[model samples]
Target: MTVTDDPVRQQASREATRWLILLQEESDDPEISAEFDAWLAAASVNREAWAQTEKAMGLVARLSPGNTSSWCDSTGGGVDMLRQPRRRIPKRAAWTGSVVALAACVALFFTAPSLLLRLRADAMTGTAETRVLHMADGSEVTLAPGSAVSINNKDGRRSVTLLAGEALFSVVHDPAHPFVVKTGNFTTTDIGTVFDVRRTESGVDVAVRSGRVQVSGGSILAQGRELGAGGGLTASVAGFHADERSAEQVGVWADGLLVANDEPLGQVVARLKPYLSGMVIVPSHLSSQRVSGVYSLTDPGRALEAVVQARQGSVHRYSRWLTILR
Candidate 1:
């Protein structure tokens, strides 16, 4: 049997396909591009695996012009077709091949590190899946969908690195072992608190549910702000925003609902993208409009429709995976 027939190889190819799709969707982000380069440099296996997957996808594109569903399936059946030895192709059939070639080019040009980070994370949550993890030190962490974190505890120091998405942390008080969460350039150290940390494309956001926490790094206003209960801080490349909300209201995404208070449509779309399976594109004109609502994360499509409808905009869905808000 060829490599594609092997279960391990097939799984890798499936995962690689997902990464390829995501990278293409977010090609405009420079941070993602840099992270992708780092991921490619981190391991030889990653490059090899991606190359093989790309080759197989190319073969599929050449053989089957427009119907990607046949070869994009994750059941290894698509790879099986590519692996067959006797498939013949005519020299000149006026093949429609530009879209497939463009997809491959985009995938190669915009590989993301999120997939690699998820593979290496100690714990992760899949699309629309939440997980509550109990740490060895009696601490608890609730991971939002599409989130990943790696834990390390040694010599009375406990820490976790938030690789992607969001997480609500309930850190146990242990003066001897301070609990810290690292996301991007920012580091949040818990002062006996329950807090939420979300890593966005540009920066990090910290919301304290109870107790207090210290946030440092990344153009933070006033040098490592200490936020108590019901306080929050958002540190981004543009600047920072310090706000206040109820302790119970923090990390509301964990409850299957997203609460947005006068947030822009673009930001709301960005927040909802991780929960949905595929691409949700909002036009630049509609993205700047303000939106405020308690939308259900469980039904992202319906929630998006509601948000757009309020502004007299409409949502056009080409497929279950592709939705365009205009």
Candidate 2:
């Protein structure tokens, strides 16, 4: 049967494609190979998936270079199906169906689950809208614009999953029932405190406003950090940064304020992206510029204008939902 014909098989194929790409990209890294070995040994399905992926790769490798494009076109697929733009192809080889099919599988694997989860989240906010939720356990959570969260209080356990965006959590002190907030691979356990959690492209940002929190995860940045009031951590692909800021300033966005301290323009733009109904594009050149200031989140357009002007840059507005900064 074709991979697409069975959802379970399709998911397995997508996961296999991800591992194959990772192994190929990091072939020189022994750690990655070890991890891949562990993954392969974890389940029989994993081994089967890898075998299927290998067969697909072999099929592409056997194709004559001149006929690769013809094969892809005949299948109504293209080289662009691959989402990894940075992936390099050898100079002599042409686009083939194996690579395109694997890419399609991997792309679906990444997007489908997240989309389904977001649609099923218990609480969610749209662009520029903040929502305050009062839980049955007396805990309060303030969701930022474009954020989504799900709560579970089962068998005397309190758990919250940050599905998307940012939120400020004021968890009630319940020593008998520990409150845990999860985002990506990291988890934050409240030690009777108030904190803000934001999901970024690289990782998660956690800022403590009151009390303390224990953070643990596979990510090096957040593993085993006890953050107290006025303390913050930004975890990203590059690494982690621990900083100090006032508790009131941690989630000032809820008060119509955007605060930044020597933050990259790209990151600042990312923070602003949620509040905006339209897309905000920052060119790579301008993305690296440093910004530090307080802007009005209530009027994101004006705030964006001020940011561009401060960097001696320009903003082009295409519509209410589309903007470009260069």
Candidate 3:
């Protein structure tokens, strides 16, 4: 059949044939298996799409070199009666169009990884805590816990939206693709440097470390800037001026390290939540007790011991859970 002869039908046939070839070539791949399973699970339309392609291939396979030569030239399927040639289709091109379809499938299979990587590059992070991801494009992002961000690359622009929690990002030298981070009411963009951000009770907190970041009017600044090496900027929900401090104390959780530099006992307990399964309680009054030391995140026990000794506070341990206070 020519391109114009039932073009829609032919296109569907080609697509279905392509997928069949893809399935055969990637039969061993778990994803392909899953996709096929899903396809098979779907309604009859999918099956129809497959059947049409198979039919097209069947027609091609039935043609011989002489017929194929004529078929190619005629721009149509021509049946010459008197000069009939033996219908021995070329092994390479004929039959169910399987060979051609399969070749296309094989080519696509090799390229699938790269395509998937591009999709994945859009956005992903882990639980219990967020992460700082450095994309291939050099854009940096601080992923919040239980949050997924998708980066859409279109028309020389990169855009990201936080599906959950919050993220603070500092975009690096990508003038071609302006970086945009969107979270509910707040939207922030980077000029090219360092900045910290997190979702708060009201809205979101945005603080620039090196480069500047623009926080929309809807932004909810951090309660207080947790300052140090890489501290946060805490601003009141209503107030504009931010209390800037080293964000290292809270930021260290990414490495599973909870560093408290003259931090209150209560705040330290809050930092430990991401690493430990259960809660660590520091009574309201004890929360004010200052703590200064380096704790081995891998072994919270060791850090607890040092803190207790240094502050003359007591330590209570209960099945992987601990409480420390003066």
- TM-score for each model: 0.67, 0.63, 0.46
**TM-score of model 1 (CA atoms):** 0.67
Winning candidate number (TM-score): 1
- If the candidates were sorted by their lDDT against the true structure, best first, what order would they fall in? 2, 1, 3
Q: Tell me the whole-model lDDT of each prediction, alpha carbons only.
A: 0.73, 0.76, 0.53
1-326: candidate 2 lDDT, tens digit per residue: 12123566666677877776565445556897788888788877777777756664553212233333332333444453233356655422333444555456555654565577677799888778999999889999999988899889889889999988999999899988899998988888999999999987777899998999988777584448899999988776567788888887988887889998888998888888888765677999999999999999878877877777789887765334457786
lDDT of 1 by residue, 125-235 (tens): 876789999999889999998899998887777999999899999989887778999998889999999999999878899999999999988655537889999998889
Model 2 root-mean-square deviation: 18.2
Best by lDDT: 2
Off by over 4 Å in 3: 1-136, 142-157, 161-170, 219-232, 244-256, 304-310, 314-326
Pairs with backbone N, CA or C atoms under 3 Å apart (clashes), candidate 1: none
| Cα error of candidate 1 at position 64, Å | 14
In model 2, where is the ten-residue run with the lowest total lDDT? Answer: 60-69
Q: Judge candidate 3 against the unseen true structure and give its global Cα lDDT, from 0 to 1.
A: 0.53
